[model samples]
Target: MMTDQPALPAPPSAEPADRLLADLIALRAAVLAEAGERLARLAPGGDAGAGIHNLANYLALRGHDLRPLQRRLMSRGLSSLGRLESRVLPTLDAVIEAAAALAGAPSPTAAPDPAAFFAGETRLAAEADRLLGEAPGHRRTRIMVTLPSEAAGDPGLVIDLARRGMDVARINCAHDGSIAWRAMAAHVRTASSLTGRRLTVLMDIAGPKIRTEAVATPDKKARIAAGDAIRFVAEGEPRPTADAPFSAVVSLPDLVTRLAVGDRVRYDDGKLEGVVESLAPGEAVVRVRRAKTGGVKLKSEKGLNLPDTALGLSPLTAKDENDLATVIECADMLGYSFVSRPEDLDLLEDALARRGATESRLGLVAKIERPEAVRNLPALIARASGRRPFGVMIARGDLAAEIGFERLAEMQEEILWICEAAGVPAVWATQVLEDLVKDGVPSRGEMTDAAMAARAECVMLNKGPEVGRAIELIDRLLSRMDGHVFKKTPTLRALASW
Candidate 1:
C-alpha cells in the first residue's frame, strides 16, 4: 500500500538550458556593444575595417571568463566556443540560437550566412598571399629564408634556395651594407625569373638595437659569473684599465645615463643577467645575478637587453633612414625591428613616404620583440594594417629576453590569435628549426616547434649552412600539419595510424 507521490516536477530539466541561453544572450549583447564602441573610435572602412571589427569582437569576447560557459555548453552537446578567433560574432550567434532551441525558446536571430561567417579566413588568406607571396601548392605556410652574405656573390645558392621552396629572401640590414643588399635583391630577382615563381625580398631595417661596443677586461680569459661586478661605460669614454674588474661600453650611451639602480639587464641573448648596482657620471655598474654554470666570457658585440628600463629610444636610427633609400628600391617588404608602439610604425611610414614608396609598393612587417609591443599589439595592428599590407613577426629571441623566457610560448600564441583576428598574416620567426638548420639534424623539440610554426602564414629560417635541408623538412612538416591543425582549431582529419 504505497501512497501516490509527486516526482518533484522531474527535477526542472530545462533550468540549466534556460540559464545557458540567458548567458549566451547576455554575452552576445556585451560583445556587440564593445565591438561597436571600438569601431566607432576607429572609423575604419574597406577591408581593413572588416578586420578591425572582427578584432574588436574577439577582444571583447576574450575579455570575459568563458570557462564555465564553455563547460556547460559542452555538457549540453553544444559548441564550446573554443575555436572562434576568426569569426567571433557569428560563432556567438550560432551558439545562442542552438541554446535557445534546446531551451524551448525562440531563436535569438536568424542563422548567419556561411560566406559572411567565413569571410575572415578568406581575407586573411588573401592578405597573406599579398604580403608574403602565395603559398606553395603542397603546403599553405610560406618559407622565408634569411640570405647569407654569400648569397650576394653566389647566384647558384639563391637559385637553389628558390628551387627548395623559398618564397621570400630576407636581407638583414644590420649585417650588410647597401651594396650587398642590392646584390642580394638582384640575385633574388634573378632566381624568381629562373624558377618562374614569385620571390619576394624583405629587407630588415636595423632599429636602435643596443649592443656591447668595446669590451675592456683584465686578461683575454676574463669571464663574468654570479656576483661579479661589471661596469658599463659610454662608448669612447675612458675605459677601465686591467686593474679594474671587467668593463664594457654600450652602443647607446644615453641609455646608460638613464639606467637607475635595480634595473635588470640581460646580455648575450640572456645568457648573462644582471642588475644595476651603482651609477656615476659616465658609467653604470651592474652585478651579475645569473650566468652559465661556471662563467661566461666577456665579449664584444653581444646584444644588451634592458627589460626593466623604459627606453625612449626611437625604433628608426639614422642608419635605418639611409638604408631605406636602398630598401625602397628593391625590397618588396620591410621588416621593422624593435617596433614598440604605433608611433614607431608612423615613423617608418613617414620614412617610406619621404622616399616616395607607397603602401602598394612596399609591405611592412612589424617585429614584436618588446613587452610594450605585446601590450599594445591591437593598436599596432590597427595602425599598420589600416595603411598597407601588414604582418607581425614574433622575434622570439629578443622578445624572450624582454618578457622572460617562461612567457614566450604563451605570448607567441596570443600574438598568432590576435593577428588572425585582424585578418593579418603573421610571420613565425626566430630560431624555427635552429638546430636542424645549423647541424643538419632536427631535435625532437625543434620538430615540434616547426609543426607549431605551421599556424603562421610564413616561417622564417635564419641563414645556416644546412638551410636547404631545413626548408625541405619544414615544407613537408607544414603540409602534414595542414591536415591536422589550422590556427587554434584542430582539423580532426582521420588518423592514419588508426
Candidate 2:
C-alpha cells in the first residue's frame, strides 16, 4: 500500500511469483545438496560401504514420495533397489539430510508458494504409501526346491509345480552338467509358457560336495579281529571273509589314532555300530557292535563323524573343485554350497564373474551348511553380499553335523534375523518337508517350521519320491500365509508411518 511505488498487478488465480521462485530454488538446492552428501557417503567409513539399506529410512525422513522418486530415478538411469540395497542404499540418508537443509535455507515451505512440484510429488508420495503397504517381497516367506537333472529334464513337472504353487525352483549343479541343466531349464520355460506364471528359478552350485575316497563293494560284512589292527584301507575291496554290519569311510589318521580297543564306532547314526578292536597307522580294526552282523553292506564315500576326532580332509571336495568350471545362467538366482570362509566366497564370486554375472542382477543364495561357514557367516554374507547381495540358505542337514544338532534350530533363527535386517532373502532347507515326502502328510512340527519359513523370503523343499504333492503342499502353505496374523509385519507399519 505504499504510495511511492506504482500499484502492482493482481495475482492470477493464486500464489505470488516470489514464493514460486523460492520453491524452485529450494527443490534444486535439495537435489544438489543431497547428491553432494550421498557422494560424500560413498567415501570411506560411510554406512553405504558397509552395505546398509537406507532407502526406506531416507524416504520417511525427507517427507518425499519414495516410490515416484525411485521410479523417476530408474527412468533416468538410476538403479531400482528392489533387493539390491547397496545400489540405491547410499543416497537415502543423504536425500533426507539435504531436504531438511534445503527447507531451512531458502525454505520451500517457509513462504506459501503455488505448490511447486506439490501435485506430482504428492501423487508419488501416495503411490509410495501403497507400495509400502506391499512390504518388501522378502516379507513373504519363500519356498525353495532342489531339482535333480532327471526332474529338470521334464518340462511338464516344472510347469505343473509352478501352477500348483512353487515360488522358486532350485537346480543343484553338483550332480549334473550344463547340458543336463539346460534340459531341465527347457522344461521350466515350457512350464512357464504353458501356465502363464512367473517362477523364480534358482541354481545351487556345488561349491564343495565333500565325500571320502571310493572303496570296492563287499558281499559279506568286514570284520577286524578283537586284537588285530588293520589300516583304513582307502582303496580296498571287501573280502569274502569280511563280516560287519555296515561300511565306513573311516577317518584315517585321526580316527585310527584316537580310538582305542573297546571304544565304539557308529556309522550313519547307528545303522551299524562296532567296537574298536585294534589300531595302527592310518588304520583301525573294529568288531561289530550288533549281535546279528554278518553280510552288512560296506561302501566307501560315506560320512563318518567321530565327534571326538578331527579329520585332516577339508570340507571342500575334489568334485567341488571340478564343478567350479561349470557355467550358470537362465536362472534368476544362485546358491554357493558349503561356503565357509571369506576366501570361499571370493572363489565363488570369481566363478560367478567368470560366468558373466558380475553385475549381480541374479540373486546369490549362500548355503551355510559347514560349521566353519556358520561361524564365519557374517563375513561370508558381507563379502558375497557385496557381489550379489542375495540371501542365505540354512542348509541344515550338513549344518546339524557341523554345529551340532542341538544348536541348529537356534542357528537357523539367527540366520533368519541377519538376512532380514540386511534385506537379503533366505531359504530354509533340509528335512523341512521330509515327512511330507516320506509319507503323504507333514508333521505338526514341520508345518510350524514351514509357516515360520514362509515368513522368511523362501522355504526350500527337497524332491521326495513324488514331487507333485510336494509342490502342492508347499503352495497351500504359502498361500495360507497371505492372510496370516501370526506376526506383526511391515505393511501395517507402512500404513501407519504417516
Best by TM-score: 1
Collision pairs in model 1: none
Candidate 2 lDDT over 1-96, as tens digits, reads 448887554433443434433443454456455644543433223434223323222322234444534443343243223322222223333333
How much is 188 displaced in model 1, in angstroms?
1.2
Mark the 10 consecutive residues where model 2 has the least summed lDDT.
Answer: 127-136
- State which candidate has the highest lDDT: 1
Global fold similarity of model 1 (TM-score): 0.94
Name the lDDT value of residue 1 in candidate 1.
62
Q: Any runs in candidate 1 off by more than 4 Å, and if so which?
A: 1-15, 40-48, 241-244
Lowest-scoring 10 consecutive residues by lDDT in candidate 1? 6-15
List per-prediction Cα lDDT, in the order shown: 0.88, 0.53
